[model samples]
Target: MFNLFVDSLIILLVVVDPVAVAPLFAALTHGESAATKRRIAIRGTSIAAGILVVFALAGGTLLDALGIGMPAFQIAGGALLFLLAVDMVFARHSGLRSTTEREQREAETKKDISVFPLAIPLIAGPGALTSVLLMVGEQGDDPFVIGTVLAVILLVLLVTLVSLLASARIMAFMGETGANVVSRVLGVVLAALAVQFVLNGWQEGFMLIEENASQMLTV
Candidate 1:
């Protein structure tokens, strides 16, 4: 349980990446007043938290409805996360974890960006959603494990909210280069985790195949 908590925390933290998002938040709310920035930060983080929680709770059901198995989802999720990790390592923006250039342009024109780029793509992006689903699915029907995962998710989101609220200060302190350096380090960690997820998926898949083969032989 302790290991699960730690692992989930690390994976979610890397995927959510509050530190990296701070700079982007700062940029997006550049000319906004303090009150407006505070409001945006709270609303954006709340929406993001809600989205992620819903995914964590219902993702496995959704996958089952699609007739998708855990091993396949795990492998695919890991691959997606690996791509996100590469983007993080290079400090580049991609649709997996960040807004596209066009999306940013659109965001600039919008007076309220809490829902568009901030909540949907920035805070609750593909990578983060995938990570949540993967973690929750891996826990199976263990209530304790699932609870731990949920707790970790909330904790990470809380950190993200605080980061967004303090975006200006964090940006001033870390700057782009400093933030990128932190991201690169975390990216390497995420890459290793992603590979482990893929390997675990392959192992589980092989075991399922072997079991099916044994059943067939018996029949």
Candidate 2:
């Protein structure tokens, strides 16, 4: 359980990447009043938290409804995360974890970006959503484990909110270079975790196949 909590925390932190998001948040809310920035941060983080919690709870069911097995999902999710990790390490922007150039342009025009780029793609992007689903699936139906994962999600979001609220300070402290360095370090960790997920998925898939083969032989 301790390991689960730590692993979930690390995975969510890497995927959500509050530190990396701070600069973007600062840029987006540039020149805004302190009060306005505070409001946007609160709203964006709240919406993101709500989305992540819902997905953590129902994502497995949604996958099952689509006839998607956990192993397959794990493999796919890991692959997706690996791509995201690569993007992080290179400090490049991709739709997996950040908004597209087009999306950014759209965001520039929008007055309220809490739901569009901030909540949906920035805070609760594809990588974060996939990570939540993977963690929840790994926990199976264990309510305690699931609860722990959910708690971690909330904790990460709270941290993200704090970062957003203090985006200017964070940007001043870390700057672009420091932020990229941190992201590269976290990216390496995420890459390792992603590989482990893929390996576990392959192992489980092989075990299932062997079990089916044995059943067929017996029949």
Candidate 3:
């Protein structure tokens, strides 16, 4: 259903939080010219798209091969989400660690902050990765749903690109306080989402165990 796509897209956006990454983008490209920043945004997002798409396409298969169930995944995802949310609430980096020493060097040397911090950890961090896994697990092999999710990702990428292009204006508008507020609010939402993920995992585990027991009784 179209609704399925919508649902998945919403979850992905919350998980990705490209808007949150905009500030980081600004920080990374602070001294660069407008032209360079634009290029970085494009390159960074394009690279991120490749990475996520690979995950989106292969996550389901990888889990199935490993015999991991959705419930287990949900719990793991929830835990990660919870941790990230807590980080966000505290004005922490949400464990992104982009503003670090080693990464800073890489950012400076590569002259492509977009691909390094902006795209990799910021846009497609651990929380995003876990969310993708859960989403892929939920969607199963539904082609339409998969397509919808991809479309949404592409759309988000576009938004990120545009935001980067307009980075200066964006910074002036949201400023530091406004951006931090959004981060904290999203963090709250993420924490709740994490709790739900853990619950879902537990429920699935119980159901699977019950099914196994019933089969034993029949035998």
Cα lDDT, all candidates: 0.90, 0.90, 0.77
Which of 2 and 3 is the better model by TM-score?
2
> What digit string (tens of lDDT, one per residue) describes model 1 on residues 75-150?
9999999999998899888678777788899998888999988998888999999998888875657889778878
Name the best candidate (by lDDT): 2
- Candidate 2 residue lDDT tens string, 1-219: 888899999999999899998999888888889998899889999999899989988898898899999899999999999999999899888678687788888997887888888998888999999999988875658899779888999899999999999889999998899999999999999999999999999999999999999999999
Residue 56 lDDT (model 1): 83
All candidates' TM-scores? 0.97, 0.97, 0.91
Stronger candidate by TM-score (1 vs 3): 1
User: What order do candidates take by lDDT, descending?
Assistant: 2, 1, 3
What does the lDDT come to for candidate 3? Answer: 0.77
